[model samples]
Target chain A: MSAQPTVTHKKRVACVLAQFDTAADVIHAAEKVRDAGYQSWDTHTPFPIHGMDKAMGLSDSRVGWIVLGGALTGLSVAFVMMWWMNGVDYPTVVGGKPPFTTPSMVPVLFELTVLFSSFAAVFGMLGLNKLPRHHHPVFESERFRKASDDKFFISVEAEDPKFNADKVRALFEGVHATFVEVLEVLEEEVEA
Target chain B: MAYYAPLAALDEAHLVAPGSTLAEVTEDIASVTERTAPRGWWIVFLGALSLLGIFGGTVGYLFYRGIGVWGNASPTYWAWDITNFVWWVGIGHAGTLISAVLFLFRQKWRTAINRFAEAMTIFAVICALIFPGLHVGRPWVLHWMFPLPNQMAIWPNFKSPLLWDLFAVGTYFTVSTMFWFVGLIPDLATLRDRSTNKWRQRIYGFLALGWRGSNRHWQNYERAYMILAALSTPLVLSVHSVVSFDFATSVIPGWHTTIFPPYFVAGAVFSGFAMVMTLLLITRTVFKLHRVVLMRHLELMNKIMLLTGTLVGYAYAMEFFIAWYSGNEYERYVFVNRAFGPYAWAYWTMVSCNVLSPQVFWFKKLRRNIPLMFVVSILINIGMWFERFVIIVTSLHRDFLPSAWGMFSPTVMDVTTYLGTMGVFFTLFLLFIRWLPAVAISEVKGTMPQADPHFHGHSERSHSEHDAHESAVGGDLVPEGAE
Candidate 1:
């Protein structure tokens, strides 16, 4: 599919993967990998493993703060929109009520706040994950597909300063990983 | 062992059947989509499609004949259509309750049913929206329901409860759908991984967002899911309260009341759980998903129905008490008329179905009895529809002036239109079953005893400490469904 051959014809290694049969093994393996000092690495599994974050020495997500920001935006926007439309522009009169009233405005305020918070929650999570990242080298390994099924995996990317194919293999073997493999992909495929 | 249940009871409780592996959970759920369509699915789908056809035809005729074909007349202007709107909206609440409320409460068993309920929520909201959209009298001007710029620069009255209904229902549907889709992403990725061919891979892959299940992704995904759940908890309660506000804000004798919000909220949850129970009983049986959807889950759901149904019964009695206690002749008359006057049959039917039928659930054996629960579930829904009918029509049809008093009855068009919404609901539900994982497979896997990394290491006795630690994390940990 490539129209032009790159300067180097060799496929590039993306990451080194270690597979485990269960969540416990993968989590303990992650702790060992974390202690060994790898930066660009992650555990892959069908579902989130409890305590895995502490095991891997990762921090809490910023999605909460983003959600709070969204909530404030929704709150202010709802108030301003309602105030501008009913209070200032039209001066609408219904059932002898005032054109603008806080009590009357509370329902819309609540709804919009929730609506915006949800938007921020979904999108913030997606953005932080850098998702829709349709191509990655780890997917090239056939055994990696089980990451979403019965298996657990930890991958240390080529970008990690400590990354070494043989060293990663030795580390994974030390942790009793059931399988270990290196992923390689065409250079141009992941260029984007 | 990772669960909080008493160790004595743990021996008997298996959330996902014993010995089922993670792969099997995925296989069990995804197989419903991958396998050939069952004969029952075909029959139900065709029936639903025909109802949709009726819905389209009746709606067309309504447009051509201009809503007059229905038996909506002077005093009963809000009959049938409005009742259908409220009933469908109420049916959707069970989905949010199961997905969001149950999630926040750490109800691990919800994993078996949350996805199914969430899909129903989205579709029920759609069915509910159909009424307001068409009944706006001029569908083209429906944009006026929102704050938008136009040549005639008027805005929807912010003071009106109807406008709030617009906002509340709109926000409810959007958030609920977002919540459902977020939960689906990981499961969709599983389907993507399991795809045997290019088409399935492409379609499921697109929906899956190319999820690789990286821990970095899960950290934020879990947080987002939690936030959505928290946000939805209040939003679900508020949506129905605002729906009740439509009646409560009015000066009409039966409509004006202070107790409407909580009363309506309880009733919404009540009817919603009944709908979920009704549909779930059928879905599990048809799809052979008894392994994931255990009898214990059904019993738990029945218990919820019993709770909410009794709450609704309390609200009904409170309404009568308040009417008599208020010393307001009009209010007292409305209550008496509802019970002993022209629409007494409808009122009594509602009481019998909603209040009496669910009383059977108080018995443990009856609660778990498949046939009996099924019958009760269907009865609760029928009663809920009557509840709205009584509230809206009965209140309107017999207002203060006996001179203006008249009866409201459903014409064929009204019946057909309401039936068509059922078509819309079932058709969407059938398609959802045919394609999506009806169970939240990833969430269910999280609930499995094996999903907890600490499960195998700690003896059963020490697991309670881990369970406490899980709650102490502010429920950030996807709970090991060790219960």
Candidate 2:
């Protein structure tokens, strides 16, 4: 089982996706799987499960850093744009005030900072999550579709070092999953 | 454990109705969109569409003619146009307050209403945007508001508050739309999964961006939501403040006051809440969402209206007191003239509607009375509009040069145009409710007792034992039943 197979196949087992009727069941299974040292596994639910982050052992998201970076960039851009436009590029004195007053520039500067930070926060989240994905192997399992509605699910990927189909099936059964399914990667999906 | 019981008891009052399962919540909320539109919806939509038609015609005629089409004159350049702009923008603020501010404060009641409020904010801003664009007269050259390179090489006057309004309103619309969309993602995914029709599934699936609701995705999503909420809280405050600057930065006596920022913000909240109440009342009745919207929610909103209304009334009095105390003849004249001058009818109407009407909520009976609250909300809406009208028209109609002062009156065009925006607002809003989950199903589910991992009677261990077991496991994952 440890040896690499040479034969080319159109499909391969990606993971065993189990469906649970309750969050506690899924969380319990996730803890068991984590204890068993499955690295490339994930749980899914309709909403964020409280303390699932610890169960899954995911670190804090990096989207905030992206937002901060975008905000600083925005501030810099605003300063440069205001300085270059009003002060250097085409200078004009209005209301007997200097061309570039800090008080007046603050609103635009603040608006731009928020604008950029928001964009960064949203797009960075999507990018980090690798979303807009048209297909995934888990979608092959009809039972897994309930992940977005009422059911709770856990999918342990084939890529995990300790992945053994027989053992994974036993583990899911031991945890009393309502349903368990094996997802298969299609030939076209691999080509795409 | 003894101390924790009270808190747990407090949370048991269902945010969602008791006996609601996750599947039921999804079905209940999503079914509204999946089903046929109600008769009431069609009636409202048709009325709004006709009004939108009137708005289109009025604007078209204005563009063909000139700014002279409206009642705007030499002295009263800012009349109904600016008034409507300020009023609509102010109404948009409550949505952000509910979604971002209340979320940050952990006010769970907001979940039922925030989605609708956010939708209203987006729609209201669209209506508000129409005013500035058209008010510029040349509407075609509205791009001049932006700092773009032109053949003339002229940059917009960045020092001007009008320029600030551009940035403020622009950023506001963008961030509000983004915040609303991001919050919609998970809900949209739920809708997608529930959808049986292939086309419906495909469309909702595409909009859902293939969301799987994976734990990792939810972790990132919650973090991003928190950051957006934090960003939006200040953004909401600043947008209205910048709008206040549009008036305050002016040398006009009534306009140039430091109190305008907070005063305007309070007034915005007051008006926005009233509008939310007005819409939600109709919505709950039509959709039969009483269980979700709840009497508690409506009463809470009324209380907010009472508080903010009082603040607005106080501001009205403060403006007068300050005007009198400052000893500035121009300032004092503007205040007195607003109350007792040519537009005094409008001013008094504002005072009665905004200040006097909401005071009825001081009685608990009145607060819970839906019909009474509905009427008061409508009155407040009308009153807030008059508040803007009084501020803009009265001050501009009587400037320093009494010789140049003129009494401004609206044209047929102005009246229709204003009414038309209402048409536009409702048309968009009607569509929103018909297609989307007006109450957030997923969010409300999160507020349920079942959502908690250690929820009593569901978990095998006692709450304290569960906590101890979690801590004992620490960074390491414990096997099932390890404790």
Candidate 3:
């Protein structure tokens, strides 16, 4: 009889990390990892650890563009409101200046634009990033409590195709990492 | 940078005896024995409460009587009342700016001062709101600023900056309160766990809202805080800008200007920083928090004052330049009047105090000299108030027609209102210091050297350094599941 037909599943992924002595060392390692054709690698640090952005091959944040859009919309809204309300709705000739003028509306318009744009920048970023909802996989480990206080970590998400628990563990060990552990995903308790 | 020091080693309490753990630091903060509240504190609290009572009594009287008792007469329709309003609002700006804008810039030193500064901002705004709210004779009709489907049938004039002020100040107060409460949550939890009395524990527990410091909670907390910080930074800028528009949108020669928004914002921050310095100096001495507050923090605040002061100075020069360059006769007269006219003493007082006094901050010794810095900060506050008085009263006292020219003087109520506001400000501040942890414990804890595993050396060295560069290589080696 022929051998039974075999099936393979390819959805899970794992990340391997090595310990470095400095932020510069981590960046250097990240660059090497990037060059080696890994697309789903990231690094975590206790603090900001400047220049890590370059190591990760990330682009400039789009937050500013979002702010600009918000500001412009805010500016336009302020200008339109002032112009329509004062010039058209309740026109008054104060200090002999023309009612349908730009200068009178400029201050309110400028203030409002800045106001709206900043609001948009903040709320937009939060919504886009899906933040503050408070769900993450890292809480399952007790040692993770130190994430903000001292420890640095690398998380290769499960969506990454290169993930394999045994293979990733071997890679991390080869790099002389101080520790390695498989992240276990538990079934969430049903609310019923 | 080589100058970087880990902040962890400094955590050892010089006040508390050695061999204390992290939990004990919380205990020291919540200690409420007879020894903790010295006799002097009772005297101070009583003094503050008396001033607050005077303030409350004056407001109550003003409400019962008419607004006519104050010195807001013709020609100078806005006298000490508006001047104090502007001054208090200006003083409030720096707290949120320091906490939120500096946070975004990753200025780590802000952790030491942000908590008290934010509290100052809230109290200052409360003082500010009183004057404008009661300025109109009908105090109950203050809600006219809002849109309502009522018998009055009055839709607020959207074009008016006064109406905009309602929205701007209200937004600022709401957002600042939210940001402040969000920050207080974790600290409240710490207080809850440490309280000896059951009532104190229950009250703090409710305020804490059941925070457990779980990873998920921390994650969410951080995200919400960053968003709030981002919100507050811009709100700070906008509130003052809207306030500036109250004058800028007008056609009065000195009041009208395109650059007023940025100019006012800079001046607000300048005065705000000075007021912060004034409060911190006294609070540090009273509470014996010199180590936590540090001379470095004072120096950093002085640097901010210098920077903002320069911007304000530039704004002063720009106002004159715009007047001359625009070739407008009235605008030129307003500029000339502010300098060489009847109120020139007030004008020059504004210049020397706001412009020149801050120059002393350039000297590191002067900046670190607590007593000298305290005096300069108080003088700056005085000068800033006079600056507003000169701007509001001088410009309006003599307008386009000399025939309408007049002088203004404050009645006793005006004087009392100003004093009462200070009383209210100090009362809240004193209560805050007594009841809560003045320093941000979580933020300070976050800056510890041992918190950075890359830190290698004596903990003392790391404790003093605000910025330390440790290797990120070790940071990345944290086990995936662990993080």
lDDT of 2 by residue, B187-240 (tens): 898888778899989988899998888888888898889999999999989988
* Native-referenced Cα lDDT, model 1: 0.88
Which residues of candidate 3, in runs, are more than 4 Å off?
A1-192, B1-36, B453-483
Query: What TM-score goes with each of the models?
Result: 0.94, 0.94, 0.71
Model 2 ranges off by over 4 Å: A1-9, A188-192, B1-12, B456-483
Reference-based lDDT, each prediction: 0.88, 0.87, 0.68
TM-score of 2: 0.94
| Candidate 3, residue B43: how far the Cα is off, in Å | 3.1
**Which lDDT tens digits does candidate 3 get at residues B186-243?**
6775665556578976777677665434322344345556666876777788899888
Label model 3 with its docking quality class: incorrect
In Å, residue B345's CA in model 3 sits off its true spot by 2.1
Error of 3 at A87 (Å): 11
| Candidate 1 residue B215 C-alpha distance from true site, Å | 0.8
